[model samples]
Target: MTLSQDISDIAIIGTGPAGLLAGYETNPSLNDSQVDIFTKSSKIGHPEHCSGLISFEGLQRLNVSMPDLKKKIGYNSIRYAKLIAPNNLSFRIDRGTKAMIVLDRPKLDGYFAAKTRKRGCNLHLKCKIHKIGYTKGYWFLLMTNQGKKSVTKSKFLINAEGIHTHLAKSLQLPVPNHKWHFPAFQAVIDGVKDLERDCSELYFGQEFAPGFFGWVIPLNEESARVGVAVGSWTGNNTRKYFYKFLKSHPRLKNRLRKDKIVKTYGGIVPGAGPISRTYHTNYMVIGDAAGQTKATTGGGVNIGGFCGRIAGKYSKKIISNEISSKQGCVDYQKQWRAFFEPNLSLMKFFRRTLSFLPDKDWNKIFQIASTTGLEKNMKVTDIDLHGTGLLNYAFQPKVITKGLKLTPHLLLSYLRGVLPD
Candidate 1:
């Protein structure tokens, strides 16, 4: 059965962080508009992946309020970091304030989805968008569910479909080259008794996570989320290698009394760098789909939220005819780049250097960190990562010097590799 409907002013694909944020920002006053969201999942939040790590500023900026902090143990701070080296050298960072908070990933996404729904945004779950095409200045979307098909027409489209963007690829849009993708695997374990409450741990040894790193992010005292991310360049099955690494780690093995695996999740992280162009005609991409994730830390929630909000705000202008020129889309791209390009560029350089570094360097770096409080010195708030600028952290001399040295390398790499033709 075919049902024809008028084209919407905006159609958002994927109900993840970017899509939800866009919906909320578009009509903060809860005004009615022709907006529709489509998602393949049966529910708003399911099959959860992601470590759910964020900063205090991120929560505030995203307007997320968690009344039960204890329930969200994944939300914690890095009061101190202990970096262990091959030579047994360790570095520690003891900062008084909490540097990060981990959230319940599925719950957080659900919350965002709820907020979007409350604001009158139409949500279509379990709907798989198979093909998207444009004709006569209007975009057409073909979606199917349970042997049934439906069509959605929109004047503007936002692709928030995460790492795999079939719509953008179909149109031959300028997607970033997949030069530095990483495979990440995570599991929620229920019986870790000795995990720290306020601090998270990371293992940087090549043996543990070959092109990337391993982490134990505490959800609370009783349970923790353990995971590893390996760069694709390493050529290892991330899931298999992560389990092997977990079985070998004496510290992790000893604390595990029960091996009750709650869930297993894995996904690809696009670390190639942000897309050189985020917009084309009436379309834009955001979040992981746009390569907005941090290459160094694999963090994108804050950046994604910021970009989604910006996109939402801009969508109004496009709909209202305030900015009728193609330059409106260009303006959106420029604003997004202005906010995230620098940090992403720096992260790419750091990821490349770290990927190629010998295990000894990690050990040395950890050792230096243990003694010099380097982690403390370099502690950045979520806002800093989300275009707050580095000037706020300029007081610490060593951190400043290190960042300065890294800036040139990042800029050079961007120039040599990522600059638009």
Candidate 2:
């Protein structure tokens, strides 16, 4: 059908997991209206930007299944890690047998999109919705594809568009004060030299990635995804910092110097936190577009997907006339924030506190980790998408005692973020 011919009860912009899940659960096929999804990319998971690491536990929480474990889905598993400090102090962390895993992100997203389509949602890829307006209780959308313009309408809208949400502003909803982003660059390398095949590494120091941290995630013994995130206060040019990180770090240079760069991509991720408000008249926002990423790690797939499911369920209720669109919108924010806010707040604090520390402090932190057997805890536990796992670090007398001596303000900053606003 022509684009102009499209009409729906719910329209979703962007095809990320958040939008796909939202469309999947909110399919309006039962009624005269439909749950229609539109994406700017032609491929299922192209224009790849996100770091593709999801904990196995995260998969179960998303209610999705991987058809293959060692074959098609994830080819590598992480059980050992080297947490290197600025002073070359390192802490070894192993998740016993398997700590974390890497996903073929593009394939994963494509898999879900196909499943969502089969679930009865009309997913239009390479489809861009440029303009939106509300009139007579309907959202009029101006969509374009290959220079062709088509008009469509929907009673409700789901905004899963990635960072720098254009719709939230175009719709003139109450926007957030500012969007803090982690300027990051990632590349695929043929070999991650000198590092353990199953061990991932985190390099800490302002010199490495001023605001955030640097990482090496192994795809296999011969390949890995290497990247770094620079905080807003430090600078926005991650490429420059990435170069600095490569040349200065001992292991990174050894691994990357002789390796071929398979591919490289860069993007911005929501760093400050979720937007202040994520609801409007007949609209709801989810995913990176709404700052639904984990504050500590900048990963959003699982958390955003979980919230997207909530959005989908609520949209269905709104379509069924069981709740008003406005009510559904409010509930979307409340429910998502209820489950994530407290954790999110603590994470935001943790990230900020990390930024506040210097290389010496990082050295102290890892020193404690190595001596205190913190790595033992990680090797056996599952991935904590929300950063709750780090809480165990604070309970140690020696760790807390050293932390206070090194960075006394850390506690104050933690309190500021944790105390309800």
Give lDDT tens digits, candidate 1, residues 1-421. 5544667888899888888898777663444567888899988766677888776666666787555344533365646545555454555545456557777777778888888888777888888888888888888898896569888789988889887777788989877556567788988888776777777777776777776777788777767778888867567589887787678776666765436778778877666668778887788788888877777777778788778888887886787777863766788788888877677766666666666556765664554345445454455444336322333343357645545545454455445343443
Pairs with steric clashes in candidate 1 = 74-102, 75-101, 75-102, 76-102, 85-363, 90-370, 91-369, 91-370, 92-369, 92-370
Residue range 145-260, candidate 2, lDDT tens digits: 76788888898888898776787787776443242468889888785566567777888887887767888888877788888988765655788887777767766676585248
- Give the number of the best model, judged by lDDT: 2
> What C-alpha lDDT, on a 0 to 100 scale, does residue 403 get in candidate 2?
63
Model 1 bad stretches (over 4 Å): 1-3, 28-31, 66-78, 86-88, 368-373, 380-421
lDDT scores for all predictions? 0.72, 0.76
Instruction: Highest TM-score: give the candidate number.
Output: 2
